[model samples]
Target: MPMAADDIETLIRTAIPDAQITITDLAGDGDHYAAHVVAESFRGLPRVRQHQAVYAALGGRMGGVLHALQLTTAVPKE
Candidate 1:
């Protein structure tokens, strides 16, 4: 089964409690998604690491239940 938007948000929030997340279904099919995540914890992280954190939050669902995800991460603006 494809992952739900709420599930994705919940998982990320679980890992990064202060994340501001926005999820979009790019294909109109639950399988493909785009996530924009902003968090204080990402302040000094590299882009690759930021994305990795989000991936980790999903618990290895990428390329399995959740096929494609276009992810963008940023630190919250002051």
Candidate 2:
């Protein structure tokens, strides 16, 4: 079974309470997804680190219950 968009969003929110997340199914399957997230936690983090934070939010779900995630993270506009 693949992950649900709501699950992805929930995971992100669980980690970053103020996160704004948008999830799209890249392959029309739940296994492949693209996530665009904006959070205050990313304010000073590098792009790689920001992504890492989001991945961590998923609790290592990448490549297992969740197959692939194309992630984009940003801090909220000032």
Candidate 3:
């Protein structure tokens, strides 16, 4: 099954409550998405780790229910 944009945002917010997230449907299909997430929790974490954290929030839905995701993660500006 494809994942909804709101569903994606909800999952991320659940894991990182303080997250400022922007989710976009890349193909007009629920299967493809792009998310830009910013949170204080990502501070000091490496870029790869930041992306990992977002993936973890999805609970292994990446390649299954949810197909492609172009993700960008960042810490809030100080």
Candidate whose TM-score is highest = 1
Clashes of each: 0, 0, 0
| Model 1 misplacement above 4 A | none
Candidate 3 lDDT tens digits, 1-78: 788999999999999999999999999989999999999999989999999999999999999999999999988887
For residue 40, model 2's alpha carbon misses the true position, in angstroms, by: 1.5
The C-alpha stretches of model 2 lying farther than 4 A from their native spots are none
Q: Clashing pairs in model 3?
A: none
Off by over 4 Å in 3: none
Select the stronger candidate by lDDT from 1 and 3. 1
lDDT of 2: 0.92
**What TM-score do all the candidates reach, one by one?**
0.97, 0.94, 0.96
Candidate ordering by TM-score (highest first)? 1, 3, 2
Model 1 residue 55 lDDT score: 96
Tens-digit lDDT track of model 1 for 1-78: 999999999999999999999999999889999999999999999999999999999999999999999999999889
Ordering by lDDT: 1, 3, 2
**Considering TM-score, which of the candidate structures 1 and 2 is the better prediction for this target?**
1
Model 3 CA lDDT for position 19: 98
